[model samples]
Target: MKSQLFTIAIAAFVASLSYARSYANEAKSEQRMNVLFLASDDLNSWLLGDTNRYAGKVVAPNLTKLAESGVNFKRAYTAAPVCSPSRTAFFSGVAPWTSGHYHNTPGANSSEPLKSALSMAGFFKKAGYSTAGYGKITHGWDQGEHWDEKIGHKRDPAPPGAPLTPSGRGEQDWGPIHLAEEEMNDTLNVDNAIHRLQQEHDKPFFIACGTFNPHMPWYVPQKYFDMFPLDEVTTPELREDDLDDVPEWGVELTLGKQKYVDSVFEHGLHKEGVQAYLATTAYADAQLGRVLDALDKSPYRDNTVVVFLTDHGFHLAEKHHWQKATLWEEATHTLMMIRAPGVTPAGGAACERFVSLLDIYPTLAELCGLEPPDYLDGRSLVPLLRNPEAEWQSTAITGLTSKGGPTWHPYLSIRSETGRYIRYVDGQEEFYDTSKDPHEWTNSIGDPEYASVIKRMRAAIPSPSDAATPLPEVLKNTRE
Candidate 1:
């Protein structure tokens, strides 16, 4: 009888030990580094330190502060220059070319590879982290199910008469709305983020806060407008014949949005438009400052990996364009900064490598010790983070979705440290030696002196079979 009791006690003790091991595993996961992903809408590189073209012309104090504490990617470019495709490329770890989602019509969640692939939020949730997203993370939060908690964003309220600037298309105008800063939509979004940061989490968290200012209808409080005087606003450098040397395909993209610029100039809203964008950007920066302050005060400050980036760059009459969707520097060059505690440098660092938003997925995965999917198109930027001057050889590729149907073919832009090379489907090309012609006023495609460079860039274009995924038959007409 004593021997039988002894055997039962041993079995109970062994089971307890196994349970303890399981508990320890859970605790380990809870101790992992947290992630604070911040995104801004329609922001350009004008405010990026050491890479700012509009130095002292834009007021983005919070963005400047964030860059001072993290690694600022001076030459970051978007995978696609449009909103839906750009966001989809980063969050889905799939490029627009692969997904065949070149436009904003068909939701990315409905697309194939994006539909099946594990998203950035999903990957974190699977790795035992609590994922929460506020504001515009994915295009309309199409993959909303991945988050343990999620909140969608809304635009700033319009004034009584609306369309304050009296130019441009739907939600294209910009001015100060007669509202308090706290009453703004972005402030409310940041409120949710601050609340999440204050709460106690049993496990590490992945929090994404996105602000939608500096986008269309750039509505913010009157105080933000007061900060940027209209007379002091600096307009982008422009040439009367900027497009005279551009290829037919490039000209087509510009003409589509030319009406907006024409209307602005006709109505004399040029300075007001520039002022509104800067004011709206400053307002967005203020909202971001709130979240950053909250993080600094919270316990997660020491361990959280904070990343700030915009979906894509906006064109403020640069290249005679008013908005995104072009493959030019004004449309594709964006702001990207990462602050990984103990991983990135103390004060800050600037990396000049040609990186893309597509790299964010793998970089975050590797930083958090999570396994990235095999199908990711971007390489991890860990080495660059460790040493800002690391030897890296990579180019950023931006694709413009083609108009659908039998003759549909996507346009490709390859950006390297040397220059930018754009290739259209008809074999027409445009090459800009950005080193000498920053405004890209001259197209060097006809110059025989750069023939070898053109050939090398042309070879980098993906093959026809691997290029664009054909848009689904049903959705092609909806957009094109």
Candidate 2:
């Protein structure tokens, strides 16, 4: 009887050991999924396949192809209209208002509250993943410690050309350069990213490639410019009275940057400027294609989760605006696409639900089976990835501080599927029934019929106390 009992105990111990080994193997497999983050600067949603009017007008075959493979968000918006604040929101999983990173102030990661938070890269690094960043990931913030390897502020040589217009906005100038595509900064960045992908790694990798093209100065190769002829190039539909219904503060914001509009018209470079923007966009697209192709040929393509997005949208003479920093659709709406290896549905579907750049952090964390920090203000997008038609109730909020002195208040815009509502700090409001007026030409805030809609949208805006303190006067009035 003693021998039989000893034998039974040995069998139970062996079974327990097998279970432990199985669990360890499963965990390792879970950790092996890689993340490839691709970012663009100042890329508007209208330049891609999101809108019917611009569809097939822009030359972005790779982006279109990538969209076909995964889920594209049709109505993704940035937390803020500028670079630093928008990127800060995504990286920290916190909104600009909550973090008080409303301006182009760099080193936001070192700020209060966010100083203790685990950045997107930091969180992945802590989870046994190798992280590397290239190009302009953060707006001038030195996040060198967050990555295992980092290449910061890489830029391409200025295109070899003369001034098209004496606007003095050197970076805003656009022309064709004489340099080869391979010699461009974006190409070099992609080359480095591809090299990393080709190497075998002991741990999964989180590679970030931020391309800085089409951002400003629109200088690219002549071939790209040739793609869009001066005569055939189409500009965003503009109405002379588009801003007629805008509030006084909103009008002030537009008038503050009237110089750019004046310059564009004064030099007869409107179509040329549009052409340059298109050329730069194409150049960015080519760089994207190269990087994506490298990944496809690499061994880890199947196990990687690819996310592509722009920092924020750009305004190419839309609403009489020349650049970003507006709550209008042209400035806040951006391009967001995710190609999660297993979670996303096949055939490149699109989710029209209103989503924010802030959601990217939590969505990526959840996709990799990691628990996102509790302080995140955005919701996980896993449900939408699983089913594009998933029931979702969310609105995208974008904020901008007016261009006045220290006394100016910030304006917040809440974007829903049906309409967009803007509430100024002084209680002045603007509402657009987007279902009828897609361009927001008319502000219907005074209409009694939509009082309930205004009430609902107003309720969504976070209280002023939850927002970060107003940026100092020195940091105010600066253009993005």
Best-performing candidate as measured by TM-score:
1
Summarize candidate 1's per-residue lDDT along 1-480 as a digit string, tens digits: 999999998998899578546644653564777999999989888886355455448888888888889898989999888888898889878777667666675556545546556789988998889999898778832567789998888776677777766685688877668878888788899999999999998888999999988788887877888887877777876788888888788888887678888888889888888888888898889899999999999988988999999988888776678989888888899989999887899989889999999999999887776667877777788778878898888689988854331213778899987788998868888999888877777899989988998899998875434423443422232223
Candidate 1: residue 329 Cα off by (Å):
0.3
Clashing pairs in 2: 68-348, 171-217
> What local lDDT score does residue 456 receive in model 1, on the 0 to 100 scale?
91
Residue-pair clash count for candidate 1:
0
Error of 1 at 271 (Å): 1.3
- Number of clashes recorded per candidate: 0, 2
Q: Positional deviation of 81 in candidate 1, in angstroms?
A: 0.6
TM-score of candidate 1 versus the correct structure, residues matched by position: 0.89
**Model 2 lDDT tens row, 43-123:** 888655545224337888888888889999888999988888788788877676666666574346544646555689988
Worst 10 residues of 2 by lDDT: 471-480
